[model samples]
Target: MPTASSVIEIPVPADQVWQLVGGFNSLPDWLPLITKSEPGEGGRVRHLTTADGGVIVERLQTFDNVARTYSYTIEQSPFPVSAYLATLQVEALTESSAKVTWSGVFTPAAGTEDAAVEALFAGVYNGGLEALRANFPA
Candidate 1:
């Protein structure tokens, strides 16, 4: 399995950032890569459409409001990955700052290059966090 991670510091309180990101289907609101996230399974599942027209289905595995974290597994996607598990966490750094970490582990799909797959996901995560930070500036 290959793992990729990205950490970003947001100039906002953790609770505030969590309010923006903690929802299982909130990706489209802040993530630049996702064009839309249609709700399903009573909001526990999201059918996400990427900006480049890729479709991905994901199921919320765990949601912890108090901990400001969530975990999800990709159920279906065009991406070259299998057994994808990803987590997003926000930690309070100060009264007006927070650290956000997004990470995932997955096995490279058949006929896919591991380095390419990892780089793609890392770019997605990093780009999303950068968009979030830009959305909420200090």
Candidate 2:
């Protein structure tokens, strides 16, 4: 499995950050690339439309409000990954600071294995984290 991770420090309480993104289908609220998010099948499935007219479908695997963590698996996507699993976790670093880590592991799609980590996982995770950080403003 190829794994990619991205971390960003936010100058806000962990609870506050989690409140913004804790919901399994809340990607549209914070993810810069997500244009809209639609829920399906009792909120377990999410259909996301990106700004660039791309669509992705994902399923919520685990969501722990007390732990401030959530995990999801991609069911359909344009990225070069199969069997992809991603987790978003928020940890307190201080009374007013927190770190958010977004990570995922996947089996690259066929011949795209070589660049999947950089082009898909890292690009999406890091870019999204950076956008979140920008929104919070350290």
Candidate 3:
């Protein structure tokens, strides 16, 4: 499996960051790439509309509000990967700082190079984290 991960440190309380990101359907609140998120399957599935009019469907695999983390799998997406399992987590670096990490493991889609897919997700994760950090400007 190919894996990619990105972590960002934000000068915001972990709880505060979690309040914005912890929900399975909250991506649109902080991620500019996601224009809207609609909950389905009793809140376990999310149908996301991208800023560019693309659609991605993801399902909540695990959730831990107390831990400020959630893991999800892509049910449908334009990204070139399969078995895409990703986790987003927030941890306290200090009372006023947070360490947020997003990581994923996946199998490259047919005809897709491993390096290409890995770099693709790494870019997505890194870009998404940067956008997230912007919400809590230092």
Candidate number achieving the greatest lDDT relative to the actual structure: 3
Candidate order (lDDT): 3, 1, 2
Give a tens-digit lDDT track for model 1, residues 1-71. 99999999988899999989988888888998899999998989999998999999999999889999999
User: Candidate 1: where is the Cα deviation over 4 Å?
Assistant: none
Each model's RMSD to truth, in Å? Answer: 0.9, 1.2, 0.7
- Best by TM-score, which number? 3
Candidate 3 displacement at residue 130 in angstroms: 0.6
Q: Which model is ahead, 1 or 3, in terms of TM-score?
A: 3
TM-score list, all predictions? 0.96, 0.94, 0.97
C-alpha positional error of residue 134 in candidate 1 after TM-score superposition, expressed in Å: 0.6
* True-vs-predicted CA distance for residue 71, candidate 3, Å: 0.3
User: How many clashes does the backbone of model 1 have?
Assistant: 0
- Which 10-residue window in model 1 sums to the lowest lDDT? 129-138
Distance (Å) between predicted and true CA of 12, model 1?
1.2
lDDT (Cα) of model 1: 0.93
Clashing residue pairs, candidate 3?
none
- For all candidates in order, the CA lDDT equals 0.93, 0.88, 0.95
